[model samples]
Target: MEEAAIGDAALFHSEQRLQQAARVNDTATIRELIWGKVNINARNSMNRTALHWAAMAGHERAASLLLDHHALVDAEDKFGMTPVLLAASHGNLSTLQTLAKAGATLTARNRLGQTLLHCAAVQGHPSVIRYVVEDLEGIPVDDPDQNGKTPLLLAAESGHSDVLSLLCELGCDLQAVDKESNSALHLATRRGHAELLSFLTSAICSDAQNQDGLAPLHLASQAGHLSCVRTLLDSQCQINALSSRRQSALHVAVERRQPPIVELLLRANINLHLQDQQGHTALDRAVRSQHAALADMIIKAERFHARSLGANGQTGELDLTLRHVGDLSRVRSVLWALATRHQKPGDWKKLALHWDFSAKHIQALENQWTGSDSYKEHGYRMLLIWLHGISSLGKHPIKELYEGLVEIGSTDLAEKVRRQANAEQEPARRCVLM
Candidate 1:
């Protein structure tokens, strides 16, 4: 009990000295405390030693003073984060350099499997990264953390072009992939950094493919990065390259509803009809995505090759010699062909069941039905009208619909539908509705 009491008293004094040193930047007082037999590596409630506080506050002098008194360089806080990681995260280059030179192991990983280099790269301190890369020998240039992201991959993903360039110069593997089999170029393209994408495209030409067989161009096209798409196209990348899923760049562009990218790919003579592993063509994907512009472009391209209507007038064949028409009739013919082949019964039912609406096909459908009146005179017209009314019912608001459903004894069904709709709409929130 007497020994325990003495140990407690010493710990109390150590805590006080650490707090005092942090407040006044008092290197002398800190040294005196260490000399007075206070534990040099004593951690407070947060498991932070005097060195951590000093480094966090950019107190290089105090940090140096502590180190001179033999403060533990590798002392970790509650998070297992060392002084070097904290210094790098706080952008204190001098303090980081001090810790490094003092034999703080550069290979130390925190609880998150992040090394000091990952922290420096993520914090965008190119100088710190360069110092770590150059000064710290044996630091793995391609070592990925828990996320399989190397420092170079993190730098590229975060749009740090200068850091990326430095990493490349230091022989960081340009082709290293993360958990998703995504290379640095994939991250660059996914983030829409055209300049970085270009640099990476030129840096690692062969290792750009991910597990999905998606190259940087396919990723850029999928993400609708028009400039990146153009850059990839102009890079002489194999325009006909297919993903592991057998999806071509054109297919992804159509699926993403990026008409500009579609146009650019078409100009490059990319096979517009190239299908994925599921045997669905680019036009099929465009129609599924409900992108009228892309569908029209594909149809026009097909007509330019003399392939008219396919079986059942649903699929169209190319007919190059056919004269292009700008009238409503011509537009109606195209919509009829696309909707018949692509829009299923379930799609029509969804249009009728949900109040969610898109005006994309309204004008073309009205023109087509008015010309022949077959859709109107036939039972299909009544079905279409009923669907339109149902689609417009819940437009007033979900709260209003909820009350209405309760009155009609359909509250349970309404709730179920609302939950399903919310789930479906989550990913689309970031998408441009048009």
Candidate 2:
């Protein structure tokens, strides 16, 4: 048992010395430790082999000595980063080459499912990425990380043009998509990388769809990339390609309220009425987005198209007027519906009184009902006289009316109506016409 304790002590001492040597870039100390029969693969408390420590510290000479001593290249530290991954992340080209030439499998993935290429690409090291892509041919160039993003996708997203070009030249499948059904084109468009987008558009066919059934053009439109949109349109790409949500570029444009993009798409003759997965057209999306101007434009365009069809038109003069009235009626109906649905008696009375007391209709009623003196006495005398007074004075006598009604101290039913009338009078006063 004492001898076993001594062996553990010796192993700990050797690992500590290797760690120190790596930190200080002490090549001689590293070689001497291995030559003196110290376990080259001995791990520290963190489970980091000497190669892991050396690579992490950017100590190429120490790392080479450990590699020469047959230390495990893919030995993971507690964090699961192998020596190759650490070296690649730190852009240690020499250490990476030594580890690779020592038969280190470049495909070793950490807990993140990130291979050495992923690390290098994420670190924006074009040379290290090139080394990994070139030297480690067995590593799948298009193999995705946990996020399902390949090295090419990562490089393009990071705007590492050189690395991106290399990946493309090596046939990295520029159209490979991530977990979001987002392709390299999608990422480039979303990141607003115009140069990378141009390259990908020119180099790769734009028909590649992501998980969303969205081709690159759809993504470009969704991202508001006008230049990318133009390029895709010029390529005769499917301008109205729909996503998994059945949303076309026109739907995305209207939803985003991008007028220029919408105009460009409209010019491209994209189907303006394309519906989404929810059976909502682009006009519906526009209305939902509250882009009133764009919605009006689309509505007018549809109306114009329908009118051009003559008698067989979807909308004739009566249909057009009805549609306009229907829109206004719908708005007013929603206000009334909300009032009734929410049990807002005050709102209901205010709206009802506003519509009832409108000057045009009230004057017409006064003129039409003047023949019956009883109706005239009730409507013309009371209603017209009060309306004339308010119109001339520009204020409803709400306070006077409240005081008069309260002074009478009427029955509970009359008092309730009076209170409701008083509660509704102020808002109605604002709507009163001069």
Candidate 3:
């Protein structure tokens, strides 16, 4: 029994070495192993024969030697990957030809239902892709895998523009989508392939949404792909296009802490008033995330747009793309400190009333409820919104801030704010609403 165990161990080591030899195309060791009467079709832990390794590595000489020794040509691995399928997947045209000539089925699919054409297209193997679709004749170029992703869709998912071009030339559907309804354009944007996204945008509509109702712009913004976002915007995609959750690209960008993307989107004519399903605007997201710079940016843009609208409801041509924040924005930290620390729970509403804020604006500011500390958040938002209105009218925020505090009967608080304002830098010194 011990001798039998020793023989079994010798054969196991020989098989492992045979697999290693086939992997590196060392045919001498393979010949020696074959002559020693080892099983040519011995499978490893993954049920992969030596032919799978040779074919996967494109070792044509090793593959042919094994086949000549009566190796199984159509042996299926754990993934149902045949030798021919592995050869095609690795872009081994010559090795694939050898397997095909050995009567290996070219149209065989893996467990995911991916054919030779699908595999070749995904790996950007143009020659193998053409050979499988044209020479095989039975496989369809638009054949979908288990996810309903055609070769073109897979090429897009893999970010292979050349493969996509070839697939398009071979009559693969440019408009093909995966099971999630993600088109080639959506997939390209999700992967942040700007060049591929640019090519795909021309062929597909940017308004197309996936199952999540997320447009390419939304994905681009959330992924922080600046070039992709620029490409989508330049392609005439909708700027304010909302998702299934009623969240715009701005909302996603803010929630995902994408400041540069938020800056870019703010340059466009986006609607700041658009709320998500949870009734949170992009400003709400920025505030909740405690990002003061991003919140101030959105406030500046929001105020600019609100002021630009005329009585006839036509928007003005004011360039809101100025990269720098103005004088009022510099006082944001002071305002936030006052709102969160100094002011009482109901003091912000009283200050808003003193500033003559309409019921609608007050209601919008008071919509969210985040426990007892929610009052502080509400106070900060109210201060920022008031600052927006004052800055838009070219009035001084510091002077108006003191007068509003005094009118709300916070006389000592108003004097302290005035002293703090005077202590600030030149930018805050420019606050002249006095």
lDDT digits (tens) for residues 191-301 of candidate 2:
667677667777677777776677777777777888878877877777767787888888877877788777677656677667887998887777666564555445444
Candidate 1 lDDT, tens digit per residue, 1-434? Answer: 99999989877977777766954679878877877887778778888888888777778889888898898899998888999888887778999888888989778888878887888787677888878777777778788999899999888888888888888888888778899888888888888888886677676773358877888888888888989888887777888889888999989888878888887777666786687998988877766665655655664454333221323443333322213322324223323432353333334334323432223333222322334433432223223333223222223233343444455555554464345434444465522311
Alpha carbon lDDT of each predicted model: 0.68, 0.65, 0.84
lDDT of predicted model 2? 0.65
Q: Which ten residues in a row have the lowest lDDT in candidate 2?
A: 317-326
Best TM-score goes to which candidate?
3
- The residue-by-residue lDDT of candidate 3 on 1-434, one tens digit each, is 99999999999999999999999999999999999998999999899999999999999999999999999999999999999999988999999999999999877999999999888878889999878777877898888999998989888888888898888888878888899999999888988889897788888989889999999999999999999999999988999999999999999999888988988888776788899999988888887777766776776676566556633434444333322226544578679878887888888989977776655556556666778888898889778767756654556677778887887789988877876776675664444543
Q: Output the number of the lDDT-best candidate.
A: 3
Candidate 3 has a TM-score of 0.80
Q: Which regions of candidate 3 fall more than 4 Å away from where they truly are?
A: 134-136, 211-214, 218-227, 240-266, 272-302, 310-345, 354-381, 384-396, 399-415, 423-434
RMSD of each: 15.0, 13.9, 4.4
Mark the 10 consecutive residues where model 1 has the least summed lDDT.
319-328
Tell me the lDDT of candidate 1: 0.68
